[model samples]
Target chain A: MRDASEPGALPTPGGPRVRLLDADSAPLLVRDHFAGGDPGPIVASLAQVPELVGPTLPFLGAVLGPSWIPLREKEIVILRTSAVMGCRYCTDTHTVVALDSGLGRDEVRALRGDLPVAGAFSDAYERALISWCDAVAFGIESDIRPARAALDADDARVVELTLLVATTVMLNRYATALGLPVSVDARARLAEEAL
Target chain B: MTALATALADESLGGRVWFYTNYHCNLTCSYCLTESGPKVARRELDRATVLDLAREAKDLGFSQIGITGGEPFLVTDLPELLAELAGVLPVLVLTNGTLFQRALLDRIAPLGDADVSLQISLDHPDPVANDVMRGPENFRKVVEAVPALLALGIAVRIATTLEDGDADDLPRLCILHRSLGVGDEDHVVRPILRRGRAETGDMGVRARYLDLPPELTITADGAFWSPFAPTVRGGSLDTDLLLSRTVRPLQRPVDAMITVLSGRPEGADSTLNIR
Candidate 1:
């Protein structure tokens, strides 16, 4: 079994420090690394290193809001992209959120193509979104071009933000590949809950 | 089968239905299947039309209904619409978590009484990574909204997208979920859809199949489906009923129904036994 306390532990030049939190049930030793002294400088220095698989919630909020895209489409794109990328972490995490967003077992299942396309997404717009997701996943940029072309001036800005949202899948895949531990809260939730 | 046959069979069994409120979405993901958002509105389903459809679905025996869109929250009267639907059938609203407002929550919170659930999507557990994917600021917004939903005593779940090497990264994602205040008791993990960008080249479909259990079903859209046919077009009356029957029987004592529903054929040992 893996050591839960040292989930993503790394040995630095000075000593050992926990890098990522493990999902397993184990007590986290927060003060162990800083016990020797105040490691403010070290912590600050670590912050300089860009996180490969970081979070995107803040960015999403600022760019997209009430007037443009709804939460459902945003999440559907995220989850669909993650699914296309084949990132389990992204898939699992988004599945929970998708549920909270009001997708039930059937709709969630339908998201994976369980239901017929004719009945799955009720509108052409949604079908277009799903198609665009496929184009990006398959490296078919041209597919999204039409959708981009169809946008009006204001909606076009939202489309730009959508591109950024799509990019997250790339980062998510990279982070998962590198073996960074999930955050503490995510681990606890997965352990006790279904996600 | 023809579309009509599919619809008839679908209607006979009374399965779940989805309503896309609009083609607009807040984010533009690279691998989106529908090319949703920005400039696509050929068929926008307004709340009234959706309610009419919902009533039809209920009459047809559908127990669950989903409200989807570029962002359902973007619809001005979404909470009211959800409220209306709650009176008839259980409703699930899919969202990105950026548009969850207090007023909406206040209106919809009471509707969770055995007939409603909210699903939020947060791609990456790490702030930087999530922000980078969703834009430069989404990470904070989603994180902030999570606590708000939880505070309402509303059930919240996080949906993370899975890519080729995500299984190895599961540990980190779990940690991230907890850090974001989502507990294991509160969420479920789901696989990413494979029909999009991930399908380009030989995106390692074999690797994705490795972690999945035997008998796991994968959708044509590339999501891990449980007990159902591989494609939505492949669904039939018999298939739907079979899925409903086999799902519960196939689940392990500790397995979640949703997990089973999201099962895929990737990564399963051929010889392993499934209930």
Candidate 2:
């Protein structure tokens, strides 16, 4: 299991203090940044939870590897989707990875809702994806009829991809609610590599 | 914009158009709505078909057109598509910032000359939270991408989804945005849409506050307005969907909110209402 403070971990500024779960009886740190109230129950519940990182990380790695989707495209969707969901922590992390994946500065800016279509994406495809993101993030009921019909063999993969993206959004909310801070050193390392 | 405005206000009479390119993406987040992947089928809309749809949208008087799927950038000829659409009406594209290249940037740079805007998603204000949502290293990637786009002279806006209990975090996010060079005037903060995996998650402290009505009336353009204000333009559709079988004359702001919140039947009841 990964401890709260690893060798290269960077302390989150103004973020929550993370206490690694060592034993079953260890007290959990439940208070989160987004959740306004008590953190006792939340932290206790998560504390000492076994095998917390493996399943999620490996599953995500397998599903998002080169065989599943291009590294660049996957990163772009993840970064933008996280942004839309208001998961700032996720957005910051994904943005760095996106740059490392070969996306340029202009492309990153566009992900923040700049030009109607991103430079690398098709206009029609961009419209469909953005609308879907908005619909899901905003809780708006969307008629995906156009998106469905527009999908061809090449685009059918989106169905699975959408589930992955949605899952990440869920995780972001959960993590933030629990008051987990960004692994500072890791984020910095990524930024350095990407640049 | 008028067509979008009209459709958002009235759900019954317009046509909906969707364009899918591919499912390939650069990041691997825990929750993805499309379940996108690289090996999956590559069903995509060709250039000619997209052009045809644009013409159809104009003919139908359907004011809204949406494009989506995995990462649309995996397609090779995106610049051409944008150039063609530039001649048509308004178009909006949703994207993650990973696939953007300088060549493509040059090709689509002209879109600003036409009426086109891009809506990017940034879930959290903090770098760690944002990266955790996508995958390791994604936070830095998106951060770097922002300044690059700004350098191109593109107008960028940040959209943050405010989950229940996340309201207070807005100021924190705003501060983060400012640090990244995003002005308060240019960013957009929104509430989280409780659907998909979100419905199954913690419901948070605010979840109990969401008072869901029944039935929602969404216009063709995708706006959920109040159904009680004599018009369904900005009203909630939940109240209308559950209370009335027909499109009731929107009369009050409160009534419209009831309708809009309840418009999407699935998971609406589970949403955390935090005022």
Candidate 3:
């Protein structure tokens, strides 16, 4: 967990492998992401390598930001992917993000694998989504019938959702491998808010 | 006030405006910043565009104009281009000094009356040591060319690119340049940057965007952070230091640079001062 009380703090168990850039140190393209906001350790780490920012940031923005798919569905894919991969940093950070995206606390806990999905997610489509996320993350074959029916066999949505999961897995590996601590704002919000 | 306000006012590193006239060179130096050679594409900026940028640069607070490239002289209209640019601001042209033969010399004879000085690359005092990196006949061409250019009353400056091992040779190079009629003030020694062809080599230092000063550079591809910004690696243009693709209006890139500069932290000096 990161200490949220201070500005520009990175209290990972051991120090990060690469230099983390603050607003002053980050270049023009990346400075806005780190400037006067809680962008977290992921962006700080990315600022060190231009190749990371050049190819990664824009693609992540397109997938993670507003899109044709509902925000709830995208958040579910992100949370489930990070949870499946055991990326604690992303799971913890996205826990707050998921809630802000209108997901129930119990639903987030279910996505994190802390609570059972049956009781938390009453919707049949969401259950199918979680099952699909689990199968894709583990790289094992499973019945795609439930997701195909729930999504009404909409290949575009299915492809987009799957791509979202893949992108989250990519971020999950990067964040977890770097041992990025959760942001202070996320920790504080998680502790105080029941939502 | 922004952080770069004071720093931008100082005319040391990021003061001048740089233009990459083209990207095709005669020699393939091991540490060449742009990976330029006879085989490379000629991404040449025409004479009209250069003159237009020079006119706008003077209004934008640039004190001098620097023209560098695969070799500025490779462009046929460079001599006339330099004379016109010199009318707006003092012009400094970086060259290999190999093309100053009788015909080219006669063509560039008019520049003797212009406010222009040629900066020629001559790395070491020894012909063998210099040619090892810059190519054969480099030392001979530069040695013979400098006197001829000087005889025409054109000011010549010797720019020595020193690697770690070549630091000791500066004194000898200094004596050699002086004997060739170039004064100490006209001689410049700079370190090789770890860019383009020098990226994998075990010499020079690495310079990212923040590592260099914001000396607005205009190229055929785009406007970049510095003269060192527009580089090529593996036969592709490196866009890491690119600021904006718009180069016309000139105000667009100038404003973009100010926006970048305003964000610069205090005392954020360049690691490699190429003076």
Candidate 4:
């Protein structure tokens, strides 16, 4: 991720992709995340990395963000893998996002792997979906890649899942290397701002 | 299994997170870590965001919370923030104790019931001696505030940076701090680790992280895994220290924490760990 290729020149003003913002302008990334909405708690956190405003950031934002991966599937993979990997920062940061994704409170709790996945999600089909999520979380997908047959996830969906896993590592590393914490009610506050 | 291997195999990592509520401080200690000074712009977290972060941290299993700033008391909504966080996790406020007005004290005194304590700096005993490193009259205000805080039934401890002032005189200073009701055990006397504005080794010897534990830090902007190297906006130090977008539904810092905290050389896997 460190091409540092002279950091390809930033786009022009009102360009399609925003440039790497200087520290003074770092707050602009919030609008990038929210589509010109009010800023969120992430603004306070992400503004520190002015480099993210560069040519690659808008692309990286699209790849790692909520655009391609279905929020449900992506959050399940992100939360499950992060929890299983012992990444408190990721798990904490994503729990509310999972809740906001329409997962039940108990379903969210069950996804942590500390509780039985079946107890919270009663439907056998739902359990199978969760089992698939567990396999993705375990990175044991080759054994279960055949099982992708049972769900509505298409071939393109598998690619999205792979992309999500690859990006989760990057996301987790950002928190670990930089020591980012889960802001309280971050998802709710951000949701409130959107409202 | 080794501690790291076992920890790596585990399912969760709990870190105490420090929220830098604002970058405003009353005095500019020569060795201040956050570059906090009178002129530092106010970048405080709102009460909703602070409480939200606290709740999320509790679910993530954080055991402690630290409210720090140019000076935490400089934020008008601090008492309300303290009351909310004190209810969820044991909290410590790393303050200069230079701004403890009774009205502010009344609002936060109930924090004692919530496991909140003050880790106010008292680098030296005599005002003249302490003021040499910190600005003028620092020792007087902190010393005066310490006893009053203790009298309010709020737990108080003296925090000192060894690199900024006299370490040899610590025995004397600790005793003077004890006179203000800070128990001998309550003293947090340590060397100033080179960070933020003090990287030139102008403060003390560089105290690089021998190893990073699973610690979380949320500044006015985003979250991080370590607090040793903070991004000072346009400053010279490497400031690629953010982990997630507060507005999104993804995460990445904990795995990186496990790899580094496991005693592997940093950047062992990727350029993420380059010093």
- DockQ winner among the candidates? 3
Runs with alpha carbons beyond 4 Å of true place in candidate 3: A1-27, A31-195, B1-7, B11-13
TM, every model: 0.40, 0.40, 0.63, 0.55
lDDT of 3 by residue, B1-275 (tens): 33233545663337688999999999999999899999899999999999999998887667889999998899999998999999999999999999999999999888999899999999999999999999999999999999999988899999999888888888899999999999999998888998888874656887767678778899998788899878877775665576666788887777667767766677676777665
Please write out the lDDT profile of model 4 over residues B1-275, one tens digit for every residue: 54433543452233466787888788877776667788877777777877877787666455678877778888888887888888888888888888887777788777757788888888777678789878887888888898888887889888877664476788889789878888888988666655556554365555333333345566665565455444452233233444433411112234334443554454433222311
In model 1, which regions exceed 4 Å deviation? Answer: A1-195, B1-14, B101-114, B179-181, B196-275
For residues A41-141, what per-residue lDDT tens digits would candidate 2 score against the true structure? 22332433312322344565565556556676667667677777766566666677777788766566566455444464655665456556555555544
* Cα displacement (Å) at residue B23, model 2: 3.2
DockQ of every predicted complex = 0.01, 0.01, 0.05, 0.03
**Which of the two, 1 or 4, has more TM-score?**
4
lDDT of 2 by residue, B1-275 (tens): 44333434554222433454444566544444333455544556577766765665555454544455556667778766765765666655656665556766776677656555554567676777776666666656667766666666555566665655667678888887677778988677655433223323432222211232212222222212211101111111111112221221322212333333334345444232311
Per-residue lDDT of candidate 1, residues A68-90 (tens digit):
55678766676667766766556
For candidate 4, the per-residue lDDT at B168 reads 79
Query: Residue A108 lDDT in model 2?
Result: 61
The stretch of ten residues in a row with the least summed lDDT in candidate 2 chain A is A25-34
Please name the candidate that would achieve the greatest lDDT relative to the true structure. Answer: 3
Chain B TM-scores per candidate, in order, are 0.63, 0.62, 0.95, 0.83
Residue A153 lDDT in candidate 4: 64
Q: All models: lDDT?
A: 0.50, 0.50, 0.81, 0.61
True contacts kept of each: 0.00, 0.00, 0.03, 0.03
Report the number of the highest-TM-score candidate: 3
Candidate 2 or 4, higher TM-score? Answer: 4
